[model samples]
Target: DDTPYDTQFCNWTVQSRFPSNQVTLGPWVNPTFLVGDFGLLRESFKNQEWGFQNWTTRRLQLTYNGLSWRDTAQVQFSMRRKAYWYTINIVIPSQIMWVMCYSSLYIRPDASPARVSLVVLSILTLITLSNRAFDMLPIVSEPVWITDYLFILNILCCAHLAQFILLHSALRAQDRRKKRKQQQQQQD
Candidate 1:
């Protein structure tokens, strides 16, 4: 017989079992709201040029688990939960940070990849740590906050690798150029 496309495989049967009673409801108190802001600074300066601008910063956010907690005494009865909150619209800034990493390809390969890669990774790691910190940040912490850190970290990671690859590629190109020059000179 051909396999049935709409075959019922489950059977319902009554079995003796004790009934359980449980109930859950929203927390008693409304969550408290607090607004905070922060920024990321990027410094661009010349060797010794006062004409050069200093550093720049981007504002961000720090979120705290909302204001709700169950006391040890109330653990037996009356349900309660820890409150939580996060930077509103965090994804927008995060995506922007990730997209910014595309600029790394513009850099020349003269710089060392090992060093640049570390810096890139550092930036990414900083972003990640900042993100984690932001995530863990409590209601009462610092004035500044961190948002989109993970997204930026992701971009920095990609850019760091790209820089390394670019450096390697440039190194290979230079090597080929030198080899060609040497061969031409020998022929001459």
Candidate 2:
């Protein structure tokens, strides 16, 4: 019962006992009446965040191998279901966060305190969201899309922090240079 996340699935079987029984067993017709208002129940099932595809395939074949003769009839019933939670919760938020992270780059670099604090908070928020993504998915070797997105977002946050530190150093250098110039002028 291990269903991979966001994967399509199907299952079915066939029954046969010589060609003689085929007439009695199948060529079955749909019943004129259903047991209940199952159609109403079906509508309820559709309300969830799932898309389903119902399908059926059947085939008949006859063959003679060197050792034996084989006659086969196969029937396959398939149902595909896709959940929307990842798209709604994970993807949308990650995209919004990415935009926010990029936008922070425009903040004035002289506002070092504000920039540092915002970057720290962004890192923490991304971490919490990544943990949530891990919890939601089945444990697997490869990362899911949301996980990858979060990792990239974290890198961007760190880059922003680094830029802030670099800007702080350059501004400090300028201040020292100005102080030296003022002292030299006073001595003259």
Candidate 3:
């Protein structure tokens, strides 16, 4: 029995005696998180109150404590958000941009096929890596994801390269034409 702010999460506890057929309990733990501006303290439980999520954290604690417990009931856990969460956010967005932009740019006729292929493949790899990294997303899988961000970034890079290549080729052709005219004039 848990009450709001008192027993609900403040003094967190769990019945973690999972049976063999069920998922193995990795030991009971208290969850702690650092958001952009706030540090959350939480405790996890397999036995939450009725109408609550089955396997979710109960409360968040703001302080850093060693992951130790006097009894088998709980272990104080800590992880750096900056070290993991924020870093992932940057990588995810970068991957999406790469894939979206490069997919189109790689198809340009004026761009070097070899370079285009390499860029596309490299970005695709990053997208895949990011996808795997975010395999345990809090939200449901959707069209937009960390992988998607990398994909779009690759595409953008390819587009920029293609534009530059196109410009270079056009200028080269123009120079050749000017030289031909000069030769013709000299012969005349």
Candidate 4:
């Protein structure tokens, strides 16, 4: 089955509509033997991550269309899956980037050029990294936790950047007023 990488492929049922004498299912899991070198990469499987959980098979009966004569058999299996690489690679890096952006607020607001440049670069980098992270995951209508975090962090960074710009403008005007007062005092 073509499933998303993050999905845990568990509890699959194989149903047969035809009348069955009996449905016997003995499902077993043959774990892939991985060497030390390849074990960490087990979850890197295409489409589905590595499923290490126990598999169970159970037989069940079903009725269809209110037909008393018709019988159905189903075999269900459960397996556990893991998706660690995406979290380690994409999630961690994005969080670190946000931390860096937050720390930029400590820069002196009087340094207008440096502060502006840093804010612009941080915004651009965050947006680019966020895009890359989203591209790694399948598109969905709801936003994931990481997506929400990134969006909120981006908003905070933008608000702080705007505040810094305003502070810088105010400081520049104050400095101009001070210079005018000093000049007037010297002439007097």
lDDT of each: 0.41, 0.60, 0.45, 0.59
Clash numbers, per candidate: 2, 0, 32, 0
Candidate 4 residue-wise lDDT, 1-188, digit = tens: 22224435444444554665544333223336321211222233334455544333444566656663333333233343345765676667666766666676777766667777766777777787678768866777765766676687778779868888788778889999999999999999
Query: lDDT per residue, candidate 2, 1-188, as tens digits?
Result: 32324545444334344543331223223333211211112222253534544533444444434433344444332343354676667667766766666666778878776677777887877888788888877777765666877798899888977877888899999999999999999999
Clashes of 3: 32
| Alpha-carbon RMSD, candidate 3 | 14.7
Best by TM-score: 4
Which stretches in model 2 have alpha-carbon errors above 4 Å? 1-5, 14-49, 59-83
What TM-score does each of the candidates earn?
A: 0.31, 0.65, 0.37, 0.66
TM-score of predicted model 4?
0.66
How much lDDT does candidate 1 score? 0.41
Worst lDDT 10-window in candidate 4: 33-42
Off by over 4 Å in 3: 1-141
Ranking by lDDT: 2, 4, 3, 1
> What lDDT would candidate 3 get against the real structure?
0.45
Which is superior by TM-score, 2 or 4? 4
Best by lDDT: 2
Query: What tens-digit string does per-residue lDDT give for candidate 3 at 71-141?
Result: 22222333212224434555645655455545544454455665556566665666555565556344433
